[model samples]
Target: MARVKQKGGLIGCGFFAHNHLHAWQEIEGAEIVALCDRDEKRLKEAGEKFGIANLYTDAAKMLASEKLDFVDIATTVATHRPLVELAAKAGVAVICQKPFAETLSDAQAMVDACKTADVPLMVHENFRWQSPIRAVRAVLDAGTLGDIFWGRVSFRSAYDVFSGQPYLATEERFIIQDLGIHILDIARFLFGDVAQLSATTRRVNPAIRGEDVATILLDHETGATSICDCSYATQQPEELFPQTLVEIDGSKGTLRLGANYQMIVHADGQTQTLDVSPKLHAWARRPWHNIQESVFNIERHWTDCLNSGHEPETSGADNLKTMALVFAAYESAAADQKAIDVRRMA
Candidate 1:
């Protein structure tokens, strides 16, 4: 693939950085010229794995030394604001991982910084880009699911997220911030802006500091109601029910995405099933590999936006609504399921 006019760098070479590295290599008109991490060991290891010779322990040093058009921050939630602000200030476009920030104000600040710098900032909220989810969005856009009034986006699994990223277990916000944010963002993406939100959160695992399970009810401006549930304690059979499923009911039809990327649509007096799972890759052999592969689609989108001067799907300003939804869920849970106004939160 030919390189784009603009070359990019990657900050924070952690568990998810490998996905970004692979995706960038696969995309045309994009090249990762440098990689940075706080830990020299991790930085060196990632550079070697990806064949990137330019490595730095300090992001500021990397940004100063490398002439990059963009930077992807794959670091933890705590580091997002500072890294994004730094990149924007350096006149580099940014692709940040979720949750956009630890708080709404910080998220807003990051977005504002990018806007002030006239550089693009996109949140890597990739759930909506999953093949099955994208297919569902296509169906809705085609008016097959006419005027959806009720919907449910659910993710439940016993997978141990704490093993690889234990920091998630100690965070003040749990599933709602870490996992539910993706589901909530998907709802907002497929539906529209939320009007109100009510939620409940519980720390199902005593070992974890924050809530490991959460359920949120949303009222969208389009009069569509959505229920979003995320949990790390769900003990369902992974074979029959693989964590992510969405059920949408419309005035005239219904669409359901079942386990293992199965899409079932009931409309026009007939039923149809669409296999929308992503194509298999060598690195994506595990059961939960799709989640990692979806990041590639998002990275490709980012590169395309940079090349064509278009906005990515998950722009920072657009993702502020998603961040607000996460905060609203936390506020609603604290208020004992009292509905929180989305507009007032802003």
Candidate 2:
């Protein structure tokens, strides 16, 4: 049976939104019917490029006028709550970008709005959708890793992220808030809900306002401990920019996701090496192809969930736990890296 394509309206035609637009074009169950942005030039450029004639400079106007099934809020953190509430008010589902809100209260409000309106709300937490990450999860699920006790999710690189998104350099919160949120979420995805968290952050790059280095320790509810470390200040020989390297140790053996998307697993007296690189989409380029592919994967998942009337894996309510970890990390860092009880905070 051919399902009717779900109508989607995308807000914020900014730097990262291009990937959303490109991925939407490839989605069979959904299509972005309208585009909105305060910047007229970017809006028109996106509309013309994507052949989306229904365009608006105001999101409210777009929501009131277009009969969309869902609104994809790809804007920055500050605007998420209002946009999400607006979408919910219009009786439409929402897919909000990460760093869900400036605070957990606002995120809860948005989640409540969607629940009140009987609409599905998903957060665009795409790191877990990455192919290599999924492959790593597959090993854990296979139980070959066996009673995972310790792990590390590391994304250390000297990549100049500010080159494409200059606003990142000016923000008071950097690596942890922007990039580490994804890494932390990945930690929760691979392990489980964190019980306690402690973090130490430092501003190694004098050029940026926020810390470019952060190492967070997590105590999972499953009695497992893991470290989520990120550093944009670290310069490596091969430069594993935009790549998340993971290592997990269990009762049986260990699994490692190294540079170049290589995965090595050892268990039961056997070791297997495999390449778990993401497929390079037609519109994607090197280095960014993995992220771009994950964008498509997650968007497709959103449509699937909508069609099946099932909740998304990274729904608003589920993401609150991830958001809790983000806030807890900052709280821990500020309190001299004190270990925080995550469940109490959440």
Looking at model 2, report the run of 10 residues with the lowest lDDT sum: 233-242
Q: How many pairs of residues in model 1 come into backbone collision? A: 1
- The alpha-carbon root-mean-square deviation between model 2 and the true structure, to one decimal in Å, is 0.7
Clashes (backbone N, CA, C under 3 Å), per candidate, total 1, 0
Least well predicted 10-residue stretch by lDDT in candidate 1: 235-244
**TM-score, candidate number 1:** 0.97
Per-model TM-score versus the true fold:
0.97, 0.99
Tens digits of per-residue lDDT, candidate 2, 61-82, equal: 9998999999999999999998
Cα-based lDDT for every prediction? 0.88, 0.95
Q: TM-score: which candidate is best?
A: 2
C-alpha-based local distance difference test score of model 2:
0.95
Candidate 1 per-residue lDDT over residues 1-346, each given as its tens digit: 6454568889989987887888788777788999999899999999999899999988899999999999999999889999999999999999999888988899999999999999999999988877778888999999997899999999988888888788988887788888899999889988889999999999888998999889999999999999999888888745432347899999889999988888999998889998888766566646656776787788888888988889988999999999999988998999999999998876
